[model samples]
Target: MLRRLLVSLVVFLVVGAIGSYGLMRNALATPICYFDSVDEVSVIGQTGHIHIGTLDNVNAWVGTYLIDLDFETAYDVYDGRYEGYCIEDIYSPDNEGGYALYDAEGSSANYEAAAYLFNQYASSVSSNAERAGLQLAIWEAVFDYGSYNLTQGNGNFYVYNGYLSSAITYANTYLNSLNLFNPDTFNASGYGLVSDDNPLSLDPQCYQDYIIANPIPEPSTMILLSSLAIGLFGVFGIRKRLLRG
Candidate 1:
């Protein structure tokens, strides 16, 4: 009976180990590939709104903009404004909304508000357990965003368009260098070909963008490996006992 149990345990462990190795290998083998094309464009002439998404999907969150608002000083704006609130954006929050700077003549107040808002919500839903409420929080946050607005001659908006453009260009170049294939395109709802003037929810433009695989490891494989390792170890111990006897 003991011998049979030991043998069974070893067999199970070997099988599980093999399976885990295979899965990890597969993930590594099929690297996500993006097009290896580099389009060098100066950030000087480019002017448009960029957006970021809540979920790792196609739709971008509203109210967020790719402006260089001094977040360090005004970072507390979003925290204080949305403190103790679980609600989300049902509309575009203009708080993070700021116009693109062409000749450097716009208010940074809205941009600052927008940046602070983006950091607030983006950091909030960092975990999978909390991500479910992200959509609601975002919508609620948008209405919260619009509460702040930019008016004429309030301050210099001075959108760092050149910095934004450089970031995008650098991202494209890096992806091209990776030689990765089958890359998924990131498109934000607030500013893109699919943008709606009065979008239902606010999605902001991305300050920077790139693709990354889901961080969480596979649960199934983890369990299997644990079970297999324990079983094999138990089996080896029994075999040693038998030999000693």
Candidate 2:
């Protein structure tokens, strides 16, 4: 009878451990929270697409509705000072098209906020940063294209497809120039730096998830999970023997 009880406990524990592990895996697969606006701004979405935009404080806001990267609410990368923020134009041909580089003017004390963002980007040895830098280069390229358009006084709007194609190539050149990423190995899957070299094709969420998920798991959670799994297995073994008896 004692052996039977032990078996039953063990079986129960094994099932529980399996269940818990499954749960953890599922949770890890899905994001806890996507992007959201911090300010009381109305998000306007593009027809037949996931893109979103808001007019309020649009100049300073940095986020995307489709591949949500709300700098205001999520990371507060622009709380005090302004280095730069990722932005998309609602009126542009593609929501993913167009980007900017902004720096706050004024005293040094108020600019650390921007510094924080730069540091975050500059310090990271991650592939995402390499891709992000590519996107930044693309943005610069597009901006230059627009400036040319303006200089020529062409009232027609600029499309992004050609620029996007060229931007990827341009970015690769820049990446090669810096020798931060491999020219031949760069792909756009957001897997690692060189694996995804196409900067324009990068999904913002993919980049964000890479940043959020790849961080080392907390020691406390690891300990808890290990303990739980061990306890569960022990109980399961006990339960199996109990049932046999």
**Best TM-score among the predictions, by candidate number:** 1
Per-residue C-alpha lDDT of model 2 across residues 117-155, encoded as one tens digit per residue: 233343342343344443333232223322222111222
Give per-residue CA lDDT, model 1, range 104-173, as digits (tens): 0011222223223233344443333233222222322233333311121111111123223332332233
Task: Estimate every model's Cα lDDT from 0 to 1.
Answer: 0.29, 0.30
Top candidate on lDDT is: 2
Off by over 4 Å in 1: 1-11, 17-48, 51-163, 175-179, 182-215
Relative to the true structure, candidate 2 has a C-alpha RMSD (angstroms) of: 15.4
**Candidate 2 structure lDDT:** 0.30
Question: How many clashes in each structure?
Answer: 37, 30
Runs in model 2 lying further than 4 Å from the true structure: 1-30, 34-135, 138-174, 177-245
